[model samples]
Target chain A: MRRGVLAVYQVLLLVLLFAAWHVLVKLEVLSAFFFGEPLQVLARIWEWFASGRIYPHLGITLLETLLAFVIGTLAGLVVGLWLALSDTASRLLDPYIKAVNSMPRVILAPIFAVWFGLGIWSKVVLGVTLVFFIVFFSVYHGVREVSPVLLANARMLGASKRQLLRHVYLPSATAWVFASLHAAVGMAFVGAVIGEYLGSAKGVGYLILQAEGVFDVNTVFAGVLVLTLCALVLDWIVTLAERRLLRWRPAGPGAAQS
Target chain B: MSPQPALALHRVSCRFDARGGGTYVAIEDVSLSVAEGEFVAIVGPTGCGKSTLLNVAAGLLAPTAGAVRVFGEPLLGLNRRAGYLFQTDALLPWRSVRDNVRLGLELRGETDADRLADDWLARVGLGGHGHKYPHELSGGMRKRVALAQTLALDPKMLLMDEPFSALDVQTRALMENELLALWSQDRKSVLFVTHDLEEAISLSDRVVVLSAGPASRPVGEFAIDLPRPRDVSEIRLQPRFVELEQTIWQALKREVLRTYQRAEA
Candidate 1:
């Protein structure tokens, strides 16, 4: 009964928000040129889907996002584990890593375009840069923070160095990495969109850029709404994976049944 | 012919470099031995470095001075012949109860790891709890899983560092009785560390006491002559148990006081 009430309240909130937006535009309190009409934006969205013009661009954007996420996560996991285990190398590279991470990474899109020639690789490279550091730092801290008692117990049980890495370090790091999945995925999407906006002929981001050039406010809003929906779908998938993989964790407030 | 001691620490000393500067001595010139099939408990004040001594015997920490021998052989790296029960929750949180128990066997590449793990879990009174993760279990249940995890490999010796200190009194006594029953079956040489004098006196064949730390060493040792097949709870009511507790506590009290004063200072 409580959950039913909550669901009703959620739908009510969305309805109220859209009604306010429509009222403000109709009253001319907000300029239609800037905010766009709600009905027109919704119709524009319907037209794109009905005509199937959005599919190709959506597919390109998603492909870039996925490729970047996979490559960046793998690179981060390997380097994180390697540096965490090797004290000398981690110490030697400490200042250099910080320097690289601190520099604004979004600026690399133009550089990547120059090198990868405005193809999917440039966008993928940008996405990988954004996703890599988030995963790398989380994994490094995870491996480093494994309980000393657990390590000692494993050693006493006769775990070799390789076995320790496989059984203890990797599993522990995986849990931390999963905790950062939502943020990492979002970063991957940001990288793809920003790269496309800067220099690209394909992708949902490029479609939005084209609409903006013609001052087509309705199409621009439609593109943004589509991207938002896509991000929500991706986040839901990540949540499902997290729930399945982390069954060992105690149920948190979000999972609590009323 | 006399059999060799299962574990021997000769003149073991550990000094840590303090965070600010200089050095701090954890344990100094602490020599001890546990004979084959013997249950020895080291009782001391809180901060007297009892766990440090156990770490030395387990070969997890290299001593600043002296040597450790296992079964008359010089010890190096990890003490492969001994199983250790840590004071804290050391079971892998990501693993289920049975998987935690299976860790040692898996590491050893045993072909029948699952079967052995099930048998050990049953031995620890967690037969149907194999599927539950560590976070799903109670504190006592987690400790039982840790015990099963340690013993699954069938090591020749056991080194437990206050393994039941975190448990409630009732659970601690029950676990103590279960441990005694298990120890009686094969009689593996055991070195148990704790600050509880009654627990030490009730569960051990001999009790060794260490002085207050900065540099701590054994101050006294006593042999417990109580009969076997004893229940830890009932044993406490026995006259001999009370006498042994008093004698050991008398020696331990002075050090405890000294440690308290040092902490306040």
Candidate 2:
């Protein structure tokens, strides 16, 4: 009963905040042209949908984000596993990898545009670069942390190298990979949008950049809101995948949802 | 029992690099033989290399010197013949009870994996519980699954490193009985390691006692003439069981005192 009441209370708070914003705009205490009233923004969003101004942009951004996310995560996981399992590979590449990771990735946005042209490919390249390093570090650490005792036990049971990786190393790294994915999703969007801002003809980032150029603060805020909502949806999808994949994990840890 | 011992350890010694300074000797000049179907237990104070010997026998660790042979075959590079029941359950947390049992067979490329897993799970008294994960099971259940996994491989010998030391007294007794039943079906050569003298005495056919560190060796052995299909309650009452327990305890007590004296010096 208390949970239900809290849910209602949260909805009520959002409504009250919007009502106050609407009243402030009506009294001219807040400038409607600059900030826009809550009702005005809502009408603008509805107009966008009815006139088909939003779908193509939304589609382009979603496609770029997803393609980049898949490519980046897979590349990171495979290479990370290789480096961790091979002592020689890790020793040789350790310093170089760290140097690359520490360098600023955002500066590569304009370079990606020049390399891949002003298309969705440029944004994807930028997004993938951003998402790769986060997942690589997490997976590398996870594989290294596996207990030597457990490895010995598996060997005694006659597990080959490939079998050991499948049974022990992969499962150990899975949780870390899933955690990295949550953060990676946001960075993926940031990379794509920044790429679009620099050179793309479409996508949410381009819309925001155009709004900024015109000094239309209301449209700029709307673009920000749209991107935030999309990120939340992507995060929710990743969480669902995590729950399905990790069904074998025992309950009663800190895994229970609030 | 074969004329040749199921497992033979001849003048085996292992030296490991210690962090602080000089090299640390884990096991040295330890020589013993366990015959087929014979249950042998090694007891000593902590850090006496009892577990290290078990690891060598399981083919998980190489001895710095000497030979360990399983059924006359040198265990120099062999790892597929013996099964290991670890001190910790070591059950994969991501696999269900049934899947954990199937892991060994899956790695070995066995076709009838499910059928083999079911048989082992039933033997371990965990029959109707193939779906539960390790977290859902109690400590004893996890250990039982670990045992079942080892049994499924049909190993020629079993190397257990204090497999039940983590259980409560009552649960441990029950598991010991369960172990005896499993051993009775197809008597595999077992080299069980433990610090508990009474446990070593009640379960094993021969108890091999070890001395303290920096090069510990086999110090004593007792043959348990206790009858087969032994009842846990009756086994405790047997005159021979009590005598063997005391003998092993006495051997262990002396070694433990020496270890403390060496540490302080």
- Among all candidates shown, the one with the greatest lDDT: 1
- Which residue window of length 10 is worst by lDDT in model 1 chain B? B1-10
Task: Assess each prediction's global lDDT (C-alpha) against the native.
Answer: 0.91, 0.87
Residues B82-160, model 1: lDDT tens digits = 9999999999888999999999999999999999999999999999999999999999999999999988999899999
Model 1, residue B51: what's the lDDT? 91
Q: lDDT (0-100) at residue B149 of candidate 1?
A: 93
What is candidate 1's lDDT per residue for A1-258, written digit by digit as tens? Answer: 598998899899988998999999999999999999889999988988999988999999999999998898888888899889999999999998899899899998999999998879999999999899889998988899999998998888889999999889998998888867778888999999999999999998899899899999988998888888888788788788777887788887844521
Interface RMSD of structure candidate 2 (Å): 1.5
RMSD, each candidate, Å?
1.6, 2.2
Regions more than 4 Å wrong, model 1: A1-4, A254-258
Residue pairs with backbone overlap in model 1 = none
TM-score per candidate for chain A alone: 0.94, 0.90
Candidate 2: give the clashing pairs: none
